[model samples]
Target: MPSALVFFTELSDAPSKAQRELLTLAASIGEPTVAVASEVPEAAVTQLGAYGVNKLLVAPANESSFLDHSLSALEAAVKESAAQVVVVANDNFSREVAARIAVRVDGSIVTDAIDISADLVVTKDELAGSYSAQAQASGGVLFVTLKPNSIEDTPQAQAVSVSVEELAVSAATAPSVRIMATEEKVASDRPKLTEARVVVAGGRGVNGDFSAVEALADALGGAVGASRAATDAGWISHDAQIGQTGVTVSPQLFISAGISGAIQQKAGMQTSKCIIAINKDVDAPVFEIADFGIVGDLDKVLPQAAEEIRRRQA
Candidate 1:
């Protein structure tokens, strides 16, 4: 039977969506083996068991403390376990790790996969979201990076004992990059856009102001997002921008305020479960696909809506 290998990053909490999807896909194929570079808490281990992971592989720490060493260790683990399919999250670090693993294993990599079917077929969008493509892994090990919220959240009942093992790392051929001081930003109360269930976004329609959008998001218990126009105008942080050139978000609910709904922006959020648009122009492209459309000034409409939502919650 073919085995699936799932690689997880070291974080404070379990990756909810990635974990769920990997477990589901693993169960679909065969037994699932989870691999971690750092220590995972017991609670997280139990959660992984509930999701159907049969084994957990841990990598040893290195003197360099670089992810390249971690990637090498994971590649070795994959080869030792003879896993035919490897699933990783589509993040900056994971992207690099996936590339390194592919080169080490002489495998083919598929990035930003939205779905997986039997026969190891993966779907992804391309050409600035103008088209979709599907490919199958025919030879060698398959490396896949999944897009957030692309897979359904289905937890299974199969639980297994978690076993941890350290992977052996090889000596580097060249000197590794030196790291200096690292500063970690304090986390905010708002949900992370990539993990949020609901995202409220603003654009140039707000006239270079994001206060209303932020207030609305707070009222709805969601994250604040922005269009390229708003980010270019300095109305919001670039990290909050959603478009082809920015972060891709597929939330349960997406609300766009004063956004014209350009194709670039839609490419980032077209897969949302529900879309609501509040634009002064009824003919704005955003309203075409909006489940709920409000033709008015967001400045006036958002305040009322936010107060109403807060009142109901209170």
Candidate 2:
């Protein structure tokens, strides 16, 4: 049977939501083989096994300093294992590595895959997520990047011994960029934006005040997001924006506060499992799609809700 190879970055403990989606995709393709870069912890390996990985391939830690070196190792492993499909988590590093690997192996590359079927037809968003496109790979090895939160997690029972392999480092042109000191952000107790099970978003209706939104998010144990209008109005940080031009999220629960829900805003979060809207205007577009609706000023409602949650927890 043909095999599928799933690539893992060093952050294996809390694998990106995209990585988990790729694992689910690999299971449907064939016996799943997980390929991890060096320095991955044993706990992560155990998690992959629990996720139905049939084989684990670990690259040497020394080979990961350069992108080309990592690709070289992965290419050798793919060829040696005869994997017909390779699924990579869609991120900056993975995209760069996948591009090089695709060129080297002469495989077809598909990015931002939302879904995959038995025939390997991959669905992806196009035109800034205004439309969807479907395509299939014809020959050689196929490479794909999975979108975060697009696939469901379904773990199965499959166990195989982990393997180690070394590939000949290929001669490549020098990269134009050099690494500099990197400062990592301090971790937060709130759920990660992309991986959060629930997300609370604020908008222009909040009148440039995000205190209530932040409080509600903290009470709910979710990340805080904002609409483009709110960000453009300087009510919230750009990183908090969520719309056609902003971050896309598909969480199990999404709560919107004082958001009018433009089409652009809806496009990014329409896929959320459940939606709740808190806006003073009952006719707001946001209320149309909300599973639950509260028509009131968010400033008044948020504090009470937060206090209730805190009281319950206490």
Candidate 3:
């Protein structure tokens, strides 16, 4: 096995838990080398070595107005390395980038992989983590994007000089699409919804009231999420939506409040380590997968739960 290229957006600093997990997966198939479009800081080198990365392939951040420059650089790195396996974090931008690289190299690509073997067999979750699907690439390179938090970051201490290599790449003539403008989202102190270990989510049973949901989430010191029905009703923003059309979250402990737990909703959060569902309807679909089910109206149950959580802290 040759070196495995781990594509990333940010590596000027330490690798995120997701990126570290990518390295862990890469190490299983081959020597894990980081491929980034950003300048690598000396401090980041030390961090990369902790995760068994001996080499870094960095393409200077693109200056052109075009968005394909970064993708082009990643594709070139994959070609230059000629690694049979490429690993990236499963996200919108990274998946798109991986797809392009797969096409350029005529490789087989798999996304949302939960586990991968050294032989390049990939294990993926389908139907919202309900069913398991495994695939083996017979020829060419194998590109894989792993779901966040699918694996824990375990550091492997190794001795080596960090060698940063310049990866040469030619940008494509024109991008298929371009962004006219960008809006910066307001920053928050809450943990990002996808990365949080604990998450509290609400659904249609709340009936447009997120007061209890937000309060309970705050009390638990976790991120808040909403079902598609809650978002469709305009109770919360689309970014907070947790379902098939929204983001997939695998938190350690997921508390689903007022959510009906349909197959669509389960697709987003079925991988949670433990689930507790609070709903007035015992017959609701949510109870099917709940580790603990509470039969009560969320309006009353949530406030009491929040109060109890706050009291424990006090």
lDDT of each: 0.81, 0.78, 0.84
Instruction: Write candidate 2's Cα lDDT for 113-184 as tens digits.
Output: 778776678888875455789998888788888877777877666544444344444444563443455567
Which RMSD does model 1 reach against the true structure?
2.2
TM-score of each: 0.91, 0.84, 0.91
- The C-alpha local distance difference test score for the whole of candidate 1 amounts to 0.81
Task: Report the poorest 10 consecutive residues by lDDT, candidate 1.
Answer: 171-180
What are the RMSDs of all candidates, in order?
2.2, 3.0, 2.2
Highest lDDT scorer: 3
lDDT score at residue 299, model 2, on the 0-100 scale? 88
- Which parts of model 3 have CA positions greater than 4 angstroms off? 63-66, 158-160, 219-221, 310-314
Rank the models by lDDT, top first.
3, 1, 2
Error of 3 at 306 (Å): 3.6
Predicted candidate 3 versus true structure: per-residue lDDT over 1-314, tens digit per residue: 65688888667476666777888878767778788876778888888877777788888776553358668877878877777788988888888888887887888899989888877789998877778899998778888999877777777756456678988877567766566777778987777898777899999988988989888888877899999999999999999999888999988889999898888898889988899999998899989999999999899999999999999999
